[model samples]
Target: MHHLTGHRNIVELRGAYEDRHSVNLIMELCEGGELFDRIIARGHYSERAAALLCREMVSVVHSCHSMGVFHRDLKPENFLFLNNKEDSPLKATDFGLSVFFKHGEQFKDLVGSAYYVAPEVLKRHYGAEADIWSAGIILYILLSGVPPFWADHPWIREDGEAPDKPLDITVISRMKQFRAMNKLKKVALKIVAENLSEEEITGLKEMFRSLDTDNSGTITLEELRSGLPKLGTKISESEITQLMEAADVDGNGTIDYSEFVSATMHMNRLEKEDHILKAFEYFDKDHSGYITVDELEEALKKYDMGDDKTIKDIIAEVDTDHDGRINYQEFVAMMRNNSPEIVPNRRRMF
Candidate 1:
């Protein structure tokens, strides 16, 4: 807490204690709940507010990166409002996935929430630049009031293989290997997809204008369900069901405009934890509490497919202590320690 006290954008830490089974951290409670809640309550923010939020986040991330403390777990839930006020200042919180980097160091652990994780992380090698990718997703949510990866149904494969790539990227030179990403990964990449052209943006804006049926500068749930279906895409029934389930935070059958927007905006963050658990499962095939290079290879095979050598290279890089195998605890700690995308303003992460 003391190490984080002076940062203008970080939440103030009050006290902490370590219990036998868990560590308790007590920080200032966010009266505003989450930035996601605020965004949902207001349907969508004004352009100025969205821009302000993005700028502030960028500044915070910039500070973290400069200090070699990356906040890899940035999301709406991790962002708190100064208070419940409409114009409350926001602060970035949560350092569980944050990391500190040394010159020439490379981060190889796979951690962070699913929706916001960079593509490279899924491949098992990424750096601080991954955080910037997540930040971009947040900006998209603030402006669009919906996650970029919002899909209507779970695309389950009978063969248990991952899904084919659905996103288009401009900066990436190679994505042929991405076809093996799971349903969640395929969907998540849409937010960072580069396939969109200027004409597409204009078309999307037109669609948004049409969906803003009430001319309120926001699209309501009623409008979405009634009008968005007109898009002519064959969305899965299960997909819509999952979306509704995800959005109904109060357990109600229907989502209010705010609740709807808030849920979508935070969906990416929700996926992050799930991905970590999946990664753990990948290494714990026998339900054992440890990970072996063989298990890692099998897991990577799902994505690396024809490129088995690549998987071996990644395992060698992460086995920094040169142990023949990694225990679960070691893997977990390594993930917590090596996430380069998380930059915090507090103490350095190693």
Candidate 2:
């Protein structure tokens, strides 16, 4: 949980203390009460609302798996709402039963609440799929207002026997939907990558050459200001400085082809659109749909990107709208047109 604290749906770990005899952890406060209690309080919950809740729970579980962590024990009691508002956010809590596992590894443990435990878990051989099974149980309870299986009457099927336990239609539907969504996402990403190929890079190279008014291999501040207007866009000196500071990773005081490509291709290389959006959110800070100078400074501080003056200049270059902030569209354009070079790397899964 400490390593995975930044996710909105996972309870944040604020602090920790360890002593000779005991350990203490401080986590975010959740005031909306337990999932079951909140559902009961409402008395009338719709399928749509239940589905939305299930979606969030699945998302949190997916994040956990992505980070190579497994909750082991997932139940309604372990999830809490941040507030008592109607649209309060839900957060997964209690890492006491969590464990880290590597890709293709399996665990042998009789862990988790009886009602939510998966059959594989009971069999003493399980992986991240166990958490998905538990999530399905939570979805069952969310829609039916009662657990599908209980301690006294647990789900059971003999090994090698045809399944007799009835599966929840809602859960089955959700599984199919998630699989379909995953497939579509992969296809879309492939298409986007194909569109931004070497041919596209060649076109950008031509644009870059046109901007290098001095016939130099790099674009200086003066060239940027004069060249942008030819493309029907005006950029301030400060903004040009910011752009150079951001793209000029080698501290060359100018934007080179590698730096330009890095800035433009960074977001495109991402496998999911949500990843790009999340990257944007990191700099947005206030959820304002636009990144202000202050927000850019805060984000840059993390990367040790540049000093105050240099950071301001990069923001000026990125803020194409001239509205003193970089909106999502402007940000995306900057990413697509002026990105750093991305080295090919394999995606790690665990």
Q: How would you encode candidate 1's per-residue C-alpha lDDT over 1-350 as one tens digit per residue?
A: 34557677788788889989998888877676788666554435667989999998998888887777877788887899878877777888988878787544668888887567887888887788888999998888788655576222346432442233222111011121122223223222332222333432332343344455676755445655555455454545554455554434344465444433333222222223443445565556786655676776665455333245654655565455567666543444343334323422223122
User: Which residue runs of candidate 1 sit more than 4 Å off their true CA positions?
Assistant: 19-22, 151-350
Q: Estimate each model's TM-score.
A: 0.45, 0.43
lDDT of 2 by residue, 1-350 (tens): 77797898999989989999998888899998888665443322568998888888998999998999988989888999999887889899988889888988899878997679998988898888999999998887676554565222223434533232222222222222223222112222223433455633433444556567676788887776665555333446675555555445445578766545444332325434454565676666688777787877665554454466756666566666578877666655554444322322223211
- Badly placed stretches (over 4 Å) of model 2 are 150-350
Question: How does residue 134 of candidate 1 score in lDDT?
Answer: 92
- List all candidate RMSDs to the true structure: 23.7, 24.1
Q: How close to the true structure is residue 270 of candidate 1, measured as C-alpha lDDT? A: 23
Would you give me the overall lDDT of model 1?
0.56
* Candidate that would win on TM-score: 1
- Residue 251, candidate 2: Cα error in Å is 85
Q: How many pairs of residues collide in each model?
A: 16, 17
Model 2 quality (TM-score): 0.43
